[model samples]
Target chain A: MTPATPRRRGRPSRTESADTPAARDRILAAAREEFSERGYDKTSVRGIAKAAGVDSALVHHYFGTKEQVFEAAITLSFAPAMEAPRTVEEGPLDGVGERLTRFIFGVWENPATRKPLLAIVRSAVNNEAAAAVFRRIIVTQVLRRIADRLDVPDAELRAELAAAQLVGIAMLRYVIKVEPLASADPEQIIKRVAPVVQAHLTGPGL
Target chain B: MTPATPRRRGRPSRTESADTPAARDRILAAAREEFSERGYDKTSVRGIAKAAGVDSALVHHYFGTKEQVFEAAITLSFAPAMEAPRTVEEGPLDGVGERLTRFIFGVWENPATRKPLLAIVRSAVNNEAAAAVFRRIIVTQVLRRIADRLDVPDAELRAELAAAQLVGIAMLRYVIKVEPLASADPEQIIKRVAPVVQAHLTGPGL
Candidate 1:
């Protein structure tokens, strides 16, 4: 460890070897596994650091507290799904529903992304602190982004209602693995559910 | 301990006092508290029996297994929501969506029902066995009933789609408690969300 090694001074000390991006990614990955397997209440910074083969100070250095670790891990896992709001912005307003639905499901359909997502949802469901982190991320990063782009009244409510429809489908089909819905083709679901989502986002009042 | 006390023949033996409806109810109530507090994977029949102040044998005799106990508790907790399907059968097909939506939300809006339902959802979310129990009860008891009554083509799929919408709303508003949607007035939500639910159940193809 050289005195000349770059450091973000004033933060708690960390091993220079643990400061690399690879080390950070490893810690984040380990945090996901610990949170997924043990859930939010049971997972700790020490556990994550041990799993990552790094010093405890390193986990704290990279992510702060256990809750911050949870936030960082969830933010990474939810990154793909969170990008769906961008789909809402890029497409014509009329087709945003199908585009957003397709984009969100596309993220869920892939096993790599889906596994972490499943872990995130399970943690969020089991722990209130995890749920609060999840809520803030989804609302501020995802739903609010979509709401900001919308021309409709009740835009935030509309964004959440749209989100609820998609989130529910994910719960039943993926998490709960409810039949027919679970086994049915993904495109088939997008076909049926997209318009209702569309209506919630842009259609006239009930 | 009267020899004349009625018992189901050939089952595991149990105390007569533990076999009464009050005892069974006590056990079931205890099981809910245990599962809710501990979640499905961590909760045990022994724990539930202990909480209810009864012998483990009596819990087994009455509920059979931990899964069965979960099924019974879920069935009981979901009883009110399950009854919403009957409203579908009673009303004109045109009005089924509003009636069904109102009925389902009504179950969630009340704190007494909401807490157990929240527990059931958390259990389902956390464990596949619990999810299976929830899926079966919902499909056979609730969604299937609504599907059976719907005259539409693709009835089961349609029923599930509608359920997905409401379940998503409940997951967000009640369980996840996302703001705006979480704090929105119940009737306002029903008014806005009911039509999308209706569309899923009965509206024209997209």
Candidate 2:
């Protein structure tokens, strides 16, 4: 439907078009576009609703708030990488580093996934609100799982330290596109960085 | 002088205010504020000149281009952290990791340096031009020096891997403000992270 189409006066029930899967997907896609283009600070719920050709109430009805919408959008975008927690569960702890690194980088290696991730990073870097949303999702969904599975001293910190290593190279290789790191063969980076990740998660104190 | 002030009838000689250190500093300061507020894609040399109450010509005269102005601004802001290369050289190879990590974290620990660094990172993540400028200066000045000092195979990649680990934590703790990692004691973080950094720089194969 066109944005010029007027919303019906009454609130639609759960069975109505507003609650349909297609409509929800449309709203989410628009939210991602708005977030990527306008960033978190400038984008508004009303704007997202308008872009999606729905009334603002429908957006609030589905997503609750702008931050909720952002969380949903990022969660969807991070779906591929979200498997990381489970990846940790599938392997022995000794090889968890390689498994996690390969899983994370494998997601990044695909251009389809990388585009939305780039958007997420750009938004997170520039706005605290966006960053908070990002941190909550990642820490809750990704890091906490890894930390929980690993029975070790400083488990939480160790998990985060491992994350920091992966996140750092992602920024350099993908976001900033720094040379050598940016263009180096994927296997080479995986080979080099995995050991550091392994150390952070399992190695004893320095 | 105000922005409304007309240019002098002709170009001022090298001895004039345009070439003076104060004028140059004003232009650089204005450039930083502009870049921080507007980001690289939206910031213009003309706008920087207007903010500094000088003709755009003088911005070019002092710093060549918008990219050049950004280079100068980041270089100045990064002055404290720039000692990293020298820090690498000051100690024995075994301790280089802790020395570099402490020195880099020391720069980040101070709010005065951290504020501008946050701006630089925000700009770099959002804009390719800014990222390129950031990459060039960082590689040429910081990472390259560290790589040059290390007589390892794939020395450049090793240096970048070391850098990636540092850059990642900075993004998480400072920019994204990821919890636990964000709130953890600084020395504690340095203690854990330094060893991984040491590995990336000097350790053997995985």
Candidate 3:
């Protein structure tokens, strides 16, 4: 008896199908551009689908909703709290300031991360739902983790202060596009700003 | 003719009419309320007029456009850079940090100033025109003065960094309503965060 060849089922295999990582990337890229250019309220699933040359249902299949697609588009993989604690854990505690500062500047300086970050800031400021998402991400992923790691008597206060300092720098230099700051030397900023971040993290004040 | 019976001319005397400080106050209060609730974009002159219980033209008379009305509603008679420089000028060059920090905290801590400041932030974030007005106000009224006062080589950079830090703290604590930060004790925040601000202003690294 001859063995029958396996029949391909639902969606065709990659070689036989049009869907690819390239397509997914194209869709997300279009989504980011649309969201940033027109804002969240005006951007539409159909528009993104057309921009990516895919059907609307394909977008739904890949990302459940406009909100979910927006999230996927602006996803920040850099977990500062996770990496920051490790930095704090290693090396002399005194240098923790410099390390943390370097990490922050590095994240912002990297183009891959900065674009999405800027989008998040612009959207959060422009839309209520996006702002709520932003607030949640900061609270749960960044602030909560950092606050938990701090040994300070007022850990929560210290964490909020730290978040303010970092986020503030991001806002001024990146979002507002203030001159000199927008073009300042990254190393110089890190050198000067780290100690202050360090102080907020582990400095001696109440 | 008996000198036209001593006629009162231009606009009828508000004293003779129903117009009162109480009425004006009611209108201004309502304007602020509406602006805060709906933002500058969603708000209309007629809407503000309705909220204030006056005719739209009356609002125009008192304050020309919605922008003008917003400016009137939120104008700060006290200038930070003006008073802040005076405060810091008295202290030793090294003490600029403490002095500047104290002055900024003083402005933000006062409810009279804080409410108007919050209104400006809300308006600025939501409306491009408002944001431009805000940027102009900050540049001419705040940053330019601060930059002029600095003896550092990167005086402008220093001033901007200082502005970012100060504004960031206010945004998180007052506008975004981030927990622990939103409700954290002001004095503790000042003590912990002020030195970082001072460092940005006059730190040795710069």
Alpha-carbon TM-score of each model against the true structure? 0.90, 0.90, 0.67
Q: Go through the candidates in order and give each one's C-alpha lDDT.
A: 0.84, 0.85, 0.69
Error of 1 at A6 (Å): 33
* Clash count list over all predictions: 0, 0, 0
Q: RMSD of model 2, in Å?
A: 5.3
lDDT of 3 by residue, B1-206 (tens): 00111212343345543356666666677677676666667678887777665667878877789887776565543344347667656767677776777788888888877766665665675466776666666766667677777776788788887777787888777666688877777777777766776788777654
The prediction achieving the highest DockQ against the true structure is: 2
Evaluated at residue B108, the lDDT of candidate 1 is: 93
By TM-score rank, best first, the candidates go 1, 2, 3
Q: For every model in order, what is the iRMS?
A: 6.7, 4.8, 10.7
B1-206: candidate 1 lDDT, tens digit per residue: 00221223342335655678878998998888777777787788977887777788989989999999999988888888878888898968889888998998889999988888988998888788898999999999988888888766688888888998899999899878898999998999999878877887888865
DockQ of 3: 0.23
Pairs in steric clash, model 3? none
The alpha-carbon lDDT assigned to residue A101 of candidate 3 equals 69
The chain B TM-scores of all candidates, as shown, are 0.88, 0.89, 0.71
Regions of candidate 1 where Cα sits further than 4 Å from its true position: A1-16, B1-16
- Mind giving the per-residue lDDT tens digits that candidate 2 earns over B55-114? 899899999988899999999987887889999998899999999999999889899988
In Å, residue A138's CA in model 1 sits off its true spot by 0.6
Candidate 1's error at A44, in angstroms?
A: 0.8
